[model samples]
Target: MEISPDAIIILKWNGIHINATIVFTWAVMVILVFISWMATKNLTIGPKISRWQNFLEVIVGYMRQQVREITQQNPDPFIPFLGTLFLFISVSNLLDIIPGYQPPTGSLSTTSALAICVFFAIPIFGIAKKGIRDYFKHYLEPSIFMMPFNIIGDFSRTLALAVRLFGNVMSGTLIVAVLLLITPLFVPIVMQILGLLIGQIQAYIFTVLATVYIASATRIENKPNKIEQKEGSKENE
Candidate 1:
């Protein structure tokens, strides 16, 4: 079996090639953009709402609520990113049902890209809310000796996120594909259904873990430092 979508070279030069992961990621982006445009084209605030609008509102409301509960801050800043994360993952997983479709989530490269995005986002959000100096200070918390451990934790967590997602998604796809080759119709169908359920669960787990990471970083920024607050008041006086 071709283990990675990246291994499927679409073009090759001296050292350059386009891969299936990039192609399918763009495909997913286009699909999302199209769906969003169609769904919001006729949005209204009246008593009667379009069915698509209603469906979108429900999903948005749920996602917003989840961000609020996790971060306990205004969900507006997070809704776009978190909603897109959930939507892309859930849709990619579900679209495995499409004939001849390769879910990009099954690729380590793709999952690593996602994890890296989260890795960068954590500090970006932290810096935005906490200020650059304070955000970096987190790495030295408890003691300066802990800085190495903090750095290691950051890398390890991102690595874990990428591997966990890729493993679950790729294994599910492989099992279903392999079963299709050897199993009877009923058996393969059962495996397909189970694969679908696993896909959905993975999407949820990834999304929730991402939310938690962002929430933790942003929450730290939101909390006031007692010593700093007292020092600030004395300076003002």
Candidate 2:
């Protein structure tokens, strides 16, 4: 059985090959863009909004709330990036129920790319909020000796994020495939439903972890210091 979408080449020309991973990833992107356009084209402020608009609003609001809760700061800036990550992975995995369709997320390369985006995003968000000097200072907290280990920790988490998503997704696909071969018809159907649920969950976990990482980077440390000073002044008075 084919383990990865990359192994299924759909086009070959002039020594270049296009695989199922590329095809499906683009397909998912197009679908999302088209749906988004359709949902917003006729957006209404009154009580007569379309169901699609209502559904999208609900999703966006929930995501914003999640980001706010995690970061304890304004959620507007982070929504676009975190929301896209959640939507893409969730949609790609949800599409696995379609027969003969391989989720691009089942491929390691795709997951790695997503993880790398998150890896860079950490620094970008950090530097944006704290400036380059202050953001990098965290790596040397307490002493310069810890800087190397802090850097290694960042790399290690990025690796974990990629492998975790890829392994869960690929394994889910593999299980469903194996069940189809040996199990009766009804059994595979149930597994497919379970797989869809798992896919949504993986999307949530990945996005939340990313939010936590970015939140850590962007957190302002001055508040606690000020609170302590106030307390000390009160004690002195």
Candidate 3:
């Protein structure tokens, strides 16, 4: 029934305290890293593969495909970042089935931190792909008058991303809690299943939005490249 994991303070020192969000976030990271290591410890390409290796490969391939479809850029470069984001959020959402666990994602702080990461990543990826000059020039698109608006758009989008995730996750947890209190058994079970579905959808959505934003930032210059390539083809013909 806790709204935020901040309610669950694990330690206090010098008037500072570590909360459930921090603890659970760390737990999620450790669990994910450990599972990955264990699963891929004996990966092989010799035809006879372990089920774990197969499962890992399938998941990785699916994520890579998703990145490629979204960005139209090389997926390998983006996979590690986007893939980890999707996996962490999805796994955090799925873990809600465990009794007496509060998903760290239910916290606004955590979601905002994630959103901030994406906000910074957009510029980092854009600059790397296009260059700092081109990336900044994008903010002045259509005219210099739009620069302030564009900067505002940047912050507003980050806020939206964070709030969107926080609202979905917190609302899901709230609904489940109410169901548990009222029906307590059968109804809550069904809601739990539905919540899992919603959680996964949210994960995909968050990842796709992130991919789209990065792609928009980086791909602006590529349009001219395509046009020139087409023009060159016509000249050769």
Per-candidate TM vs. native? 0.89, 0.91, 0.91
Ranking by TM-score, best first?
2, 3, 1
Q: Please, what is the whole-model Cα lDDT of each candidate in the order they appear?
A: 0.82, 0.89, 0.83
Clashing pairs in 1: none
Off by over 4 Å in 2: 222-237
Relative to the true structure, candidate 2 reaches a TM of 0.91
Better of 2 and 3 by lDDT: 2
RMSD of 1: 7.9
Instruction: Mark the regions of model 1 whose C-alpha exceeds 4 Å error after superposition.
Output: 12-15, 221-237
Ranking by lDDT: 2, 3, 1
Q: Judge candidate 1 at residue 147 and give its lDDT.
A: 100
- 132-235 per-residue lDDT for model 2 (tens digits): 99999888886999989989979987888888889889999899889988985898888888889989988998898888788878988744444335323422
> Residue 201 lDDT in model 2?
89
Write down the lDDT that model 1 would get. 0.82
lDDT at position 190, candidate 2: 88
